[model samples]
Target: MKKAALYLLLITLFSKILGFTREIVLSHMYGASNISDAYIVSTTVPTFIFSFLGVAIATSYIPIYSTIENEKGIQSANIFTNTLVHFVILICTLLIIVAFVFTTPIVKLFASGFDKKTLSLAVLFTKISIFSIYFIGLIYVFNSYLQIKGKFVIPACIGFLFNFVIITSIILSDFFNILMLPIGYVLSYILQFLFLLPFLRKHKYKYKYSFIIDKDTSYYMKRIFYLSLPGIFGASVNEINSIVDRTIASRISVGGISALNYAINLNSFIQGLFVLTITTVMYPIISKMVVESDVDGVKKSLNKAINSITLLVIPITIGSMIFSEPLINFLFGRGAFDSKALSMTSEALFFYSIGMIGFSLRELLSRVFYAFQDTKTPMINAAIAIFMNIVLSIILSRYLEIGGLALATSISAIFCTLLLFINLRNKIGSFEIRNIIISFVKVLCASLLMGMISRFFYYALLNNINDNLCLVLSVCIGAITYLVIIYFMRIKEINIIVNVIKKKLFSSFNVL
Candidate 1:
């Protein structure tokens, strides 16, 4: 599991870097302006719409496939896959028509702050980008299929192609018409879908073209639909929170939407790099364990995953908070991203960092509940969180502006994560929550100390060396400080990692 996680981590890291570059390119070309804001809202509308169905289906599809494959065999799973593919295409096709017809109103819904000119631009972009959902839906199905087949490489690589295409499209827009932006966005997903086809064949997946919802298909399809309801509600509630944030942001200022988007992309970077890699690797194993009725194994896996998330994400959260400005400035200070944009983005990033651990754990815990095929728990918890977020965002944004919106999200996530942990313990008859809390405290202490030292080091050298160089060195120093502190603290998770590194080093010496 560690080996698989590591492999996917490297691939995910590369892909996330490219994804970040895509954002950087957009910021460089468009910055926190009406153009970037319109493009973001345009792209977000389709993704938000598709996610209501696509995410719920894709997430629910996994354990369902596991169940079928275990009972009926590989061919049965393939049939289900084919049926789902056709179903998604049909649904997404309908969605595209509705969204296209109502593009202006939908864009208006997301960004009520936009004026006539900006609204027109956003509608145009949404019209083009909305079609990408067809490809996006298929990618979700195929990616889930590939992951079930234990082919993580190709799915992980899709980000590479997807982000590369997006980056290219942004650059092309600079030279050509800005309309190339949405056009290229759609093209990326088409290429991603095409890229996944042959690999599906290589994995022995025979794509039979059948849209007939026959008896067996109907039964299982209905089951998927039933199982997906809670998930869809959960996802929809979360999307509502997002729409609320964006809507409020739109009202806040000119580039409020773009600033939130940029900050979110940064937050997503940390989640993708560690939390996602661990969860993606563990989800299948946990699902299989549940299928085999290995309750002990599931408990161990949950404990380990939770511990890993704390050990990794806590320091990142602290470091991000400490150096938010320098980090944002270093990454996005140039091009059209001026001082005001940097200040807005940096403030948002700092506030968002507060909930990093909450966000990471909530995602992992939610998936665990899904493995148990109990999506209702997460759904209820999400409803609570989203309600809190909506209320907090409204009240907080009045004072904190963009920062308040992000802070509200962080607080809500943390609250939701707490609910998940408690309910999971109740359902599973208790894992190692006490131990996890103890370790979390230790990791928090180490990370806090490291942050202080890193902050001091950064300021000490800020006047002596180049600002970016100083920031990079300070991050390196903080990492070293964190490792040293954790090693001395004898944190169990860090010890496991340390032992593995030692053994690898000893093996290399023997090889020499």
Candidate 2:
């Protein structure tokens, strides 16, 4: 588990850095403009379709696949994957065709407040972008298979290909104009999907094309279908919140959607760093444990994950709050991105940052539900959260604009996190509630102190140093201070992190 988590984290870290570069390129090229808003709106539905359905299929398929592979054989598992992959393709392709045929109305629904010309550009972008659904769905299956096969590196690496392609496309768009944006969007998905093929081949995963669903395959489909629907609904509801946020932001101002997108992207970068890495490793392990009825093992993994994730997420959240403006200015304050854009992005980002711990906890807790084949609970909780999000977004966007949209998101997440925890304790036993709370308090206090120090240094260096330099040094001090506090407190989770780094370093030396 440690090895898988580390490998995924390293690969994810690499991709996220490039992803930052991708966002920086976009901010420089477009800033918070109508073009940016249109692009964000255009891609929202397609990405939602995949994230909604594709993640449901991919996540729900894994435990069952593990069972088949273990009980039936590798041959059976391969056939199951092949069948599911093709079926996902068919469903996604049909949906995309439908989406394509209704592109104008979809764009209208996505951002009803757009002017006629902006709406037309958005429709065009949506038409071009919707085709990515097939690729996104197909790749999700392939990527899940890779992870199941203990091939985390390739799956994570392919995201870099997607981001790099987008970055290149953004660069080219400077010369060519807006057409390159949607084209590059589609092409990135295609290239990333293609890149997965070589790894599929290397793994000797045979593609036995069987359109007919035999009784056994029928059983697999029924099981996966029953299992995936709630997940799909839950995921779709969550994505709808994004669509809702974007649509509301569209009504707020020209750059509201763009600002929201920037905030989301920043949060995603933070999430991909550790929240995603740990859960990527945790879900499969816990699912297997659930299948075997290893109650103690499931409990152990959940406890450790919550603790370790907190050890990192809390500090990062505090650091993000302290450095929000500087980070935004450093990454995006250039070219088309002006002072107003920077301020909007930073303010929205601060609210997003406040939800950092909530986001991580939500993911880890939800995965436990999925592992136990209880997707309905999370789905139901997500529904409740989304309802609040919609109500709060409408009320708050009236007053606070983009920041209110973001704050509503954060508030919903916190509610979801708390509700999931309460439900999870009733479902399974107490996940050491007292201990978890104690650790969180310690971490929170330490983070607050570190943030103070970081803020002081940031202001102290603001006039004496370059913007980026001040930001970098302040962040370094904040991180080092966090480390020192954790060490002095003798947090056991620190040992887990240190041990992983040592092993990685030694492994590199041995390879050398």
Indicate which candidate wins on lDDT.
Answer: 1
How many backbone clashes can be found in candidate 2?
Answer: 0
- In candidate 2, which residue pairs clash? none
lDDT of 1: 0.90
RMSD (Cα, Å) of model 2 = 2.2
Clash pairs detected, candidate 1: none
| Candidate number with greatest TM-score | 1
Residues 163-276, candidate 1: write the lDDT tens digits: 999999999999989999999999999999999888877636555556665457677888789878898866565577778899999988889899999999999999999999
TM-score of each: 0.98, 0.95
The positional error of residue 116 in candidate 2, measured at the CA in angstroms, is 0.9
lDDT of 2 at 115: 92
Worst lDDT window (10 residues) for model 1?
Answer: 203-212
Identify the runs in model 2 with alpha carbons over 4 angstroms from their true place.
Answer: 203-212, 499-512
